[model samples]
Target: MSLRPNPPCLNPQTPPPPQSELDNIRRYDVKAIANYYRRRPWKVLGRALEVLWSFGFFLTCLLWDQWTHQVEYYKRQRAEDLRELLTKLGPTFIKVGQALSTRPDLVRRDFLEELIKLQDQLPPFDNDLAFQLMEEQLGMKVDEAYREISAHPVAAASLGQVYRAMLFSGEEVAVKVQRPNLRPRLSLDLYLMRLGAEKFGRFLPLNLGHDLTLIVDEFGIKLFEEIDYLNEGRNAEKFAENFHGDAEVKVPCIYWQYSNQKVLTLEWIQGFKLTDIDKIRAAGLDPSNIIKIGVTSGLRQLLEHGFFHADPHPGNLFATLDGRMAYIDFGMMDQLEPGTKETIASSIVQLINKDYLALTEDFIALGFLAPNTDITPIIPALENVFGSAIGQSVQDFNFKTITDDFSELMYDYPFRVPAKFALIIRSLVTQEGLALSLDPNFKIVEVAYPYVARRLLTGESPQLRRQLIDVLFKNGKFQWQRLENMLSIARSDTKFDLLPTAQLGLQFLFSEEGLYLRRQILLALTEDDRLHTDEVQRIWGLVKDDFRPQELVNVAWNAVREFSLAGVSTILPQR
Candidate 1:
């Protein structure tokens, strides 16, 4: 993908030209270009000073070996200072810090903890400038577009501020007005960031597994998309379509007539923040159910819909009075390719079944391991990490331990998380943390199991069906233990009907390969001399109960007759 500059829009009233026409357009923002050159020196100096100050503390701690005990204290202090510096640097750096908070591979836990608190809340821009931009972009006066508009912003953030307004038709809406000259400022900042990233990749001790240039380029694209209010409006519409008729989730409707490149008008959702458990409970709502709905919806986006809300923090989510999850700020969204989704679903199944070998294969398939890499070394490591949780219920499993262990393994192995996978992990971890705060006993896996199982049981994917069969059948024979575990998990959810799963299994059994599998089971039963009479009877009873088809029953009878004849001959003995 080439990184061509986006053409400047000379007239905000007209729609921006498409990518094909960008090269033909000669529009330019001379003011933005001059401003960039004027501010470049000061911005560079400020960043240098901030970096020097941050590293100065660390160097002092290192050189003064006598103050070793204070090393940790100084390290924490430096991290806090770096976070403050990023916050002070403005919108671009704040976003960078927010992205860094999600990357456990790049930073330590203390730094991550501090960086995650970097809020995007900023003081509102001048109200007059906001109103003027709205009018200029929407090609209408503020009053013509809305019946009533707040003189002050209802909420202020890094890139935009939202005002409560009523449309001309009396529909209450939220108007998000972009920060003045954000496009030019962001372009300049991202250009500098890209240069810095290239330098860091050359000098820093990091193994990113990919080009830093590409990563920065991708980040720049996403940031630019976020600043495009029309893009955000379309994202909201896509989400609304995705969740149409979903009673537990709600997406704000967009008013396109009053929206433009720099100004977005959306249905204003009146609800409490998701973290306001006390207030939610006061309104006769169950916080646990709310979290459950959020988890399920998030899982569906990842596993079923392929598109997900990448930033689902408390601020971006709300618990409405109608008991539906209202998601706002559709600026950051991630899409999972079909192949990635398949790998994820298969990984979940393998984790549930405790299939370490299959899990290793999944990692390899997902590009976490090289194709030529020997997975034998990793299998024992996986066992060491997940063995304790093998037979435990989802509620009893420790998700933190798994994540920690995985982090450790990444340090030891050739594992690198792609940007999309990283976002998915970050979103889930953040959501899980929120859910835990709401209900200490909440188990994310417990809520996600039904969805995973439903996909495996009913999905049309042949690869997934093969994985399901692999989970249920081992060594060419049906594994009752694994089957029972799956059935138990399925039964745990009252809404999940096991009939479809049973039918799927039976359909497979009656297939040609399944007939061969039946023969393998018969051979195993007949050849095992340790089987006593009672044991044989129990096995026969189980087979008869499960395999109702006459061909299967006949095969079982023949195997039993041959075994009995062999037993009599052995007892009569002469051999």
Candidate 2:
């Protein structure tokens, strides 16, 4: 793709947000909120009454359904009622419903099926107001800027709605306009929710190991980010950069000239929702392959880039005509702190290795367990919870099932998801749900393990290199099959190169960290005081087909070149 200095937009001079909208961009602050609402007691009272009334109505309907349990009929009816209630309750509750949809542990299966609809089924605001705001933010009349625009929103989401439009230049685009007065309403609901979580959270019939208030606060922060169209535009650009040359993934470009705090314009995509299996198949695309792109791309985001779209529901993802998984709505994106990504990757390795003790420590290190908390009791619980779930094959391992069991374990123990990891869990769970929609028997780990294996095999970082060693060697014994398995899996990835992997292996085998590994290799080869060349011959036999002699020579030459460059650079003066 060719780079442009400044992509033109409908409005060359988009207006900045007013003072009121600017105030909404601030971080979540409970003290400031309480103080701000102190002088507006009437507003608080009115919203509180409204919330209570809505909850009462929802509960009454649920109770009535329970009283008349007419087999499977009422069950579906109850789920529908819950979906409608959340829709009526507005965006904050809608978001909560979306989160609950991914938690098989919290919601019944039927309700989960219904709640997922909330992702894009919310009602849109007035068309007149939406168009007017689009004009006002862009500083250009709608007709003058766009040759044609949709009469109604193409899709209505919790925070905003998308309209398909065409520019005067005949370029197709998607114009996303935020709902008017969204900030104040969301802020108020979040404040009220936070207050309730602080005051009466414990009394609820819930077993989350963390403070509910913190979760509310985190949600509030992301909600604020989502409302800011400019922030989301920047997020989109960054995400695009992260997957710059990746063929399997696509991210829409932001037209900055026509975008501001409340208005966003981007490339319009003609595609099918990931859940639309029939449409996907009709388009000559394989649903399973589309899911693979989604899973692999998701893994790259969380593991490699440490930046990811936290909200990846069906509506926000689409299977493009060209077989690329396009990600939309960059709002609600999160960044993993340094080392956190490696820790997560290591946990996956530990899980596959069935080292429950190490996995328990990984949780503590990841902040799922509080410091100074005793973990002796937790290790066995984790083992028992995951052992049966991970049964014969990774292909049959379901993430939701593990989380369901994990929720019980968390309730019994002091396992709490850190605020930082809340969205991580939600994103992963939602991605898994999306995959299951396309392929019923899909296992997240089936795709995830291959990606992890590829990373472990060729990763240059010391931490990842150490993990590679950990996978290959167990209890000071060299595991030939483990090495063979990793190589087999890693080679399956398109980006995997055998020569570089072998080069890294040789480099590490001689490095300081490899001292223990070298000792193990020597011990294995000299077992019973007799040199055994069988294992070495076996590994060579496995890789000989792909590891060409020319590639080995190239690896040697490149290593020499790198070493020479390093020596020369060290002796030269600092810039």
Candidate 3:
């Protein structure tokens, strides 16, 4: 069967349903699709054949160019061809291309540059069809629902196209209408792709350490969620809730009355894309500060809230005129379990410590390795891959370079990216790419480490506190320089609490969990039973400037008063 375009069929306009009916729209469920197409053999076969016809020739051309060693000669042409082919294949392929754009290790530079155009540059579908679909979904005339709306789409993307509209209340909003026939097209393509992966894996010489079909399934699940406009609205609200009271971050409010399964209405933002460095500067905002906000917010999403916006391409992130960072397009989102979040945070520590053995364990804990897999040989490979990149100040580390090297390592070793981590890697890599686009010298680790440092120093979570202890004391010895560095970095964060940190330090120093820390401090201050004041003097010298004279007196008075009250009670309060 040869693939051909399907004109969007229009559904008859009807009256708007009640809120309860809209809420009943099917939500995202990955398990429901696991064996979803087993009975539809003919449908799967037809779609599979259509896919083969569409991509088979392209793959053949690629293999031929490689075989003749002429790939460099025709690279640009091949890239253009690949982009057009994916676009022709519809939303599913377009999404896959966008995901591939961030992977430097998987896709070459020329092809990656081309694939990036897929992010927000896809061709718009028929505007008339979009209007028809909106009316059908919202059960109201376009003019009745909006005071004014764009005659044409303001922007077009894989799953939907966006229109600028105004409410009757005089508020501006961006109305997103889903592409016609998106669900069935996506469903058919995903099944065919999964089946192809399963069948082809038996013969292909590829060893990516992960099952390709599982990756396809993961992609399908997220894509399904993305197509549901209602789910996207909920994701935006939840993201706003997580970032409540954050002055530097902005999330648009959803207009629930005008939104449903096929249409999304939210506050219209007038801002420049973070990648637009020139406009950002013209608006009197520092691009560097904007980059910091992006990286910091991304860290909070992944490490702190365990929820993250997976697709953070240039289009989805904006710099508002007021100098705050605004995030849009909440369609693609993911969450990490609490344990998974802690493991990822610990992986960062292992990378910094250059403990490849522990890092290997982290990968296993993250599901990149099987429980019974032998990691003895993988440790040295990991050390070789990450040692130099992280050996210097972590600021010298580059994500793209590391990813390229790691990709090769995955092919050679037993390393496979877990299905859940696909978007995490994509998000991190895209953020780095976005930063580099704005500033060639930008190092994501520089901005990212400060947030992590603040979390470690001031976070009250028991798990995080334990990790901090591990970072400070290793092999029964205190790492004073590490402590000093952590404090220095954390001090730069505006939210870092100086007094609370001091209190926490004292509490840890005297608590049971602080036994190891106390012993290490004692060892640092004494040698062969002779006490030395040099260590204590150096510490006081480092911290003396941080304490005001009045603050010191207050702390003294509080301690003395408590002690005196306890003594009086012991001696005289015998009743």
Clashes per model (N, Cα, C within 3 A): 0, 0, 0
Cα lDDT tens digits for candidate 1, 1-575: 11111123322355434433222212233344335545568765665566567657656755664466665656677677667767666678778887776566567888877786764445678999999888877877899888999989988877889999997676788999988867655665666666678777668665556677667766776777788777787787777777877878888877777777778887889899887889999999999889989998998898877889988877789999989888999988878778778788888878877788988988888877788887878898888878765446666665655776687777666777777776787788878878887998888888887678777766456566666766666666566565445555655666775444455554444444355445544554554454344545543453343455765655544433543454423323132
Q: Which ten contiguous residues of candidate 3 have the minimum total lDDT?
A: 1-10
Question: Could you say which candidate leads in lDDT?
Answer: 2
TM-score result, candidate 1: 0.78
The list of candidate 1 runs beyond 4 A from truth reads 1-84, 100-117, 388-393, 499-575
For model 1, what is the alpha-carbon lDDT of residue 83?
A: 78
Q: How far is 492's C-alpha from truth in model 1 (Å)?
A: 1.4
TM-score of each: 0.78, 0.92, 0.87
The alpha-carbon RMSD values of the candidates against the true structure, listed in the order shown, are: 9.5, 4.0, 7.1
Task: State the lDDT of candidate 3 residue by residue for 463-561, as single tens digits.
Answer: 787777777776666676676777766666666666656655655554555566666676766644767566556656656777888877665445335
Better of 2 and 3 by TM-score: 2
Evaluated at residue 110, the lDDT of candidate 3 is 92
What are the lDDT figures for the candidates, one per model? 0.71, 0.81, 0.79
